[model samples]
Structures are given as structure tokens and as C-alpha cells.
Target: MARIRIAVTGTDGQVARSLVERSAMTACDVICIGRPMLDLSRPTTIESALASIAADVVVSAAAYTDVNKAETEGALADLVNGRAPGLLAAHAYARGIPLIQLSTDYVFDGSKSTPYTEDDPIAPINAYGRSKAAGERAVAAAHPHHVILRTSWIYSPFNRNFVRTMLALARKQDEVRVVADQIGNPTAAADIADGILEVARNLIEGRNEERAGIFHMAAAGTTSWAEFASAIFSASAERGGPTARVAPIASAEYQTPARRPANSRLDCARLSRVHGVSLLHWHSSLGPCVGRILEQGT
Candidate 1:
């Protein structure tokens, strides 16, 4: 049997880094292209990159992830997050390859009491969310063989994420205030990448298309920003890294340029049924990620 060839975009980002590291364990050949190599700003580059590679599957992990900054740079965010992945989907359609695109929980306004499912209506409150929503629609229109995985509050040891931010503050400050109103799952990049690979493998083998669409892939448990920060601190403390107090605050206390949803929780039931994959609870994934941050002195 020939090993599956998978081409991944956004090699420089956290999710891409995790995919590269994890793909080595599988019987798959991973081809990773970074920002300059396949810049999202140049949508044509997405098609060019796909045409240049001979892969059974294409995974687009690259995105404009800065939510607050997206308000000021909406056009740039839309270009990278919306248009680029659309081009990749089109290219994949032309080549008869499966494209797996990463999306976000920000696509929904967080008005739903329960976790948002794949069929939930999208009404993004922020620029970044809107851009990702656009990307989701574009990919669906361009490619029939595609998986749009909507995840939330992703963190990894490799990049600048919430876990790192909390650890850094705990080291420097005695007490840190985190918003408790915004609720969502704290997904690990490694875990999310694993789910992506599962979906990709199924698609490549013609088993997952019946379940393909917008599936929410997040850690099982829901948590607020304050609770998540507390988990990070608790994990760090267990590793003897930092000892600091965490204070809970309302979202109104912290002012940011972009408006965030009070409830950003996602439902992964469809993801589980379709992909036959389960995510570790946020607390379990936090320890290793926080430990890495402590080891790296970040």
C-alpha cells in the first residue's frame, strides 16, 4: 500500500507545527509550506501551491487568528482567512483531492445556551469571526470533498496562546484578572490536528464524506477565560513553575477592540460521530502544554 501524501499550509503556525510533528507517527508523507512559501495574502499562491504538490489530501491550518486586531485590519484578515482557503478548496476540487479547512467558534454569536452544532446559524459578532465564516462558506461552495472543522480557544506550547500568556503573567505578577463571562473549550492544537488527520484520512479513503460539513472539534468540557487561566496556573504550579492568584472578572472589566461572545462553547457530537474521534478534556491537555511553556521559560 502506498503511504498517503498530505500537503499542509501554514507551516509556521501552531496548528501546522503540531500536524508536522504528529504526522511522522502515521504512514503518511507530510508536506508543509510556511507563510512566505505560500502566503495567504496571495490567494493565487494557494492554487499554485496545490498544483505544485502531488498529495492525496490538503489541510489548510493557516489563518488570520488575531481576533482583536482583525477589527483594524479587516481586509487583510478576510484575504488570508476567507479568500485563501477558498482558493485551496477550488484547487482541491480541480485535482479531485480532499481539503480540510480549519475554522473557529467565533463564527457564532454565542447566543445559544447549548453547544453550537454544525447546522447552527452563523452570525459572527467580530471581524475575525466574520472572515472565518466567509472562508467556511467559500470552501463549501468550491469543493464537495472538504471538511471544515470549527474549533475554539486553541492553545499550544509552540506558539503565543492563552496558556503561555497566563504562565508568563503568573511568573511576573502576584495576581491576574481574567474574564469569566466568555465560555468556551480550551482546545489543544495537537488534539485538534489529530482530529483533522482522522477526518483527512477518512476523506482520502472515501469514508468521511457522508459526514463532512462544518463539524465542531473542541475539548469536551466548557470553561470561562478565568477558569482556563486558573487551570493553566494550577498546572504550572504542579510543575513548580509559578504560583500566583487568579481573580475572576467580568468581560466588561477588560476592554478590547473586538467584541467577543459571552458564550463560545461548541458541540463536538457530530465530529465524534463522523470522525469517530474524541478529544481529551481541557484540563488533561493543559498540563503538558503548560509544562512545555515552563520548560521553555515562556
Candidate 2:
């Protein structure tokens, strides 16, 4: 059997890096494209990049992820996060290939007390969320075989994320302040990459064709920024890494240019029912990722 070629975007991003790393363990050939080759800001490069790569599936993992910065740079964010995936979906549709487009929990207003389901209404409060929501609609409109996997609080050892930020801050300061009101699952990028590979395999095998739509993929548990920080510190302390006292503060106290969802928890029951893929608990998944970061001093 021939290995499936999986072309992914955002070569420098955490999720993309995870996808590349995990692909080595499977029979899939993961090709990562970014920057000059496939710049989201320049949509013209998208088709050319896809045309050059002979991929069985396309994973649109790249996005302008600066939540606070998006408030002022809405145009660039919309181009990269909102419009680029749609362009990629169109190309994928032309090639009769599956396009797995990553989305965000920010699409919701986080007003619901319970975890967000795939069928929940979307009311994005920030520019970044609005852009992601736009991307979701565009991809769905462009291709029928598209999967918009909405995830939250993505972290990894390979790139800049909450885990790395917390650890870096811990090294410089004895105390760190984090927002307590906001809550979400602190997902590992490697876990998300694993889920994506499962979906890619199913797509390549022509299974679960009816499951081509939106689904939530996230860690099994939830926590606030402060709690998450404390957990990171706890894991770090266990490994003789930098540990700091986490001070919990309300969101109002720590103001940002963009508003974050108070509760970004997503319900992954649909993903389990449709794809039979379940991620590890956030706490359990954090350990290895933290350990790797500490060991690498990254």
C-alpha cells in the first residue's frame, strides 16, 4: 500500500509541528508549507502551493492566532484566518481531496454554563473569533468533504503557547498572575495531531463520509488560566524545573485589547460518536509536554 501524502500548513506553528513529528510514527507523509511558499496573506500562493504538492489530503492548520493583536489588525487576521482556509478548501475540492480545517472555541460567546456542542449557536465576541467563524463558513461553503475541528487552549513543547509562556514567566518571576474567570481545556497539540491523523486515515480509506462537517476536538478536562498555570508549575516542580506561585485574578482586573470567552469548554461527544477518537485528559497530557519542554529548555 502506498503511503498517504498529507500536506499541512503553518510549518512553524505548534499544531503543524506536532503533525509533522507524529507523522513519522505512521505510514503517512506529512508535508508542511508556510511563509514564501504558502503565505495566507497572499491567497494567490495557496493554489500554486497546493498544485505543486501531490497530497492525498490537505490539513489547513495555519492561522493568525494572536487574539489580542487581531483587535487592531483585523484585515490581516481575516485574510489569514478567515479567507485562506476557504481558498485551500476550494483547491482541495477541485482535487477531490479531504480538507481538515482547524477552528477555535472562540466562535462561541462562552455564555453557556455547560460544554459547547457542535450544534451550539456561534456568537464570537472578539475579532479573532469572528475571523475563525468566517473561515468555518467559507470552508463549508467551498467543500463538502471539509472537517472543521474546533479546539481550545492549544499548547505544545515545539512552539510558543500557554505552557511555554507560563514556564518562561516562572523562570523570571517568583509569582505570576493569571485570569481565573476564563475556563477551557488546555489541549496538547500532539494529541490534536493524533486525532487529525485518525481523521486523515478514515478519509483516505473512504470511511465515515457522512461525518464531513464540524466537530469539537479537545482535552477531556477544563481549567482556568490560573489553575492551568499552577498545574504547569506543579509539573515543572516535579521535574526540578522553574516553579512559581500563581496568583488568580479576575478577567476584568487583567485587561486585554480583545475579550476572551469566560468558558471555552467544548463538548467532544460528537467527535467520539462520529470518529471514535477520544483525547487524553488535559492533566495527563500536560505531563509529557511539560517534561519535554523542560528537558529541551525550550
Candidate 3:
């Protein structure tokens, strides 16, 4: 088979970097465009870059990810996360290719106790979530050939994520205070990358219209942030790395500019049933990543 060309936004993001790495192991080519060449904040750049790239599929992985700062920088977040995706979808539609937009679980208000499904109504409590919700709408409106995959609690060895932060803090301190109230799947970026590839391939090769829709794809299981930290430390300890005692705290105690969902757990059944993809359990993916960070110090 001919190598599939996957055009992605952003170069340094965990998902984009992981996609490039994962594509190397497959018959797919990742063309990552970002920053000076293709900034999400700049609409003209997104258009020009997508127009020029002869890709089989496009993945919009970059976004204004600072949850707290987004409360203050709502305008920038709106432009990057809200309006940019429509342009990506419109361009990809013009070329008759599928566009995949990476979204978040923050779109929900966290009122429901169970895992969120694709049909859940969005009532974002924060600026970042609102912006991402807008992007999802724009992508859906702009093109029929779009897949909005909402993921949660992304971590990897490549970028500054929860796992790396926890490990680094363990190096400096004995006990770590983490919020235990907010629960979600601690998805590995590597797993998200692989899932993205599978979904893109289904759309690209099979032209599977069933795959072009919103889907939740997260790590198999769920845990509170504090518990996730404890699990990470446990994995680190096995590798003779930095270990820490996790002090579980409430969301009220550890406040942030953005109010996170109490329950960010996503039901990924549709992603599996439609695209034939499912991520490993949180701990299963997390252990290897923790081991890598501990060993390589990435």
C-alpha cells in the first residue's frame, strides 16, 4: 500500500509528536506544520498550509491547552481552539479528505456521575471548555468529513504532562498533594496517537462514513488525579525511580482559574464499535511511560 500522508497541526504537542513517531512504525507519513508556518491563532496560515499539503488526512492536534490561563486569555483561546478547526475542516473538505479534530472532556459540566457519551449535552463551566466546544461545533458545521475525538488527561514522555510533572515533583519532595475529586481517564499520548491513526485510516482507506462523527477515545479505565499520581509513583518505584506518597485533596482545596469537571471520564464504546480502536487501561499505558521517563529522564 502507498504510504498515507497525514498532515497535522503543531510540532511540539504530545499528540503531534507521538503521531510522527507512531507513523514511522506504519505505512503513513506525518507532515507536522506549526508555529511560524502554521499557527492556530493565525487563520491565514492554517489555510495556506492545508491548501499546500497533499495529504490523505488532516489532524488538528494543537490548541491553547493552558486551562487556567485560558480564563484570562479567552480571546486567544477562542481563536485557536474555537475558530481554527472550522478552517481546517473547510480546507480538508475542499480537498475531499477527512479532518480529525482533537477535543477534550471539559466540554461537559460534570453533573453526571457515569462516563460521558457522545450524545451528552455540553455545559462547559470554564473558558477553555467553552472554546473547545465552539471548535467542535465549527468543525461539524464546516464539513461532513470530520471526526471530533474528545480525549482526557493526556500524558507522555515528550511533553510537560501530568506524569512528568508528578515524577519531577517526587524527585524534590516526599509527599505530593493532588486533587482527588476530579476523576477521568489518564490517557497516554502514545495511545491517542495510535487511535488517531486507526480512525484516520478507516476514513482514508475505507471512506467509512460511519467513522466521520464525534467519538470519545480515552484510556480504558478511570481514576482521580490523586490516585493517578499514586499509580504513577507505584510504577516509578518498580523501576527504582522517584517515589512519592500521594495526599489526596479535594478540588475546593486546590483551586485553579478554571473549574474542572468533577467527572471527566469518557465512554469510548463508540470509538471501538465504529473505528475498531480502544486504548489500553490507564495503568497499562501509564506504567511503560513512567518507566521510560524514569529511565531516560525525559
State each model's CA lDDT, in order. Answer: 0.86, 0.93, 0.92
TM-score of 2: 0.98
CA shift at 19, candidate 1, in angstroms? Answer: 0.6
Tens digits of per-residue lDDT, candidate 3, 123-223, equal 99999999999999999999887899999999998878999999999999999999989999999999999999998888877665666899999999899
Please write out the lDDT profile of model 2 over residues 197-285, one tens digit for every residue: 99898888885468799999999989999999999999999999999998999999998999998989999999998888999999999
lDDT leader? 2
Q: Rank the candidates by lDDT, best first.
A: 2, 3, 1
- Candidate 1 global CA lDDT score: 0.86
For each candidate in turn, the TM-score is 0.97, 0.98, 0.98
Clash list (residue pairs), candidate 1: none
Error of 2 at 51 (Å): 0.6
**Residue-level error in angstroms, candidate 2, position 95:** 0.7
Q: Evaluate residue 124 in candidate 3 and report its C-alpha lDDT on the 0 to 100 scale.
A: 98
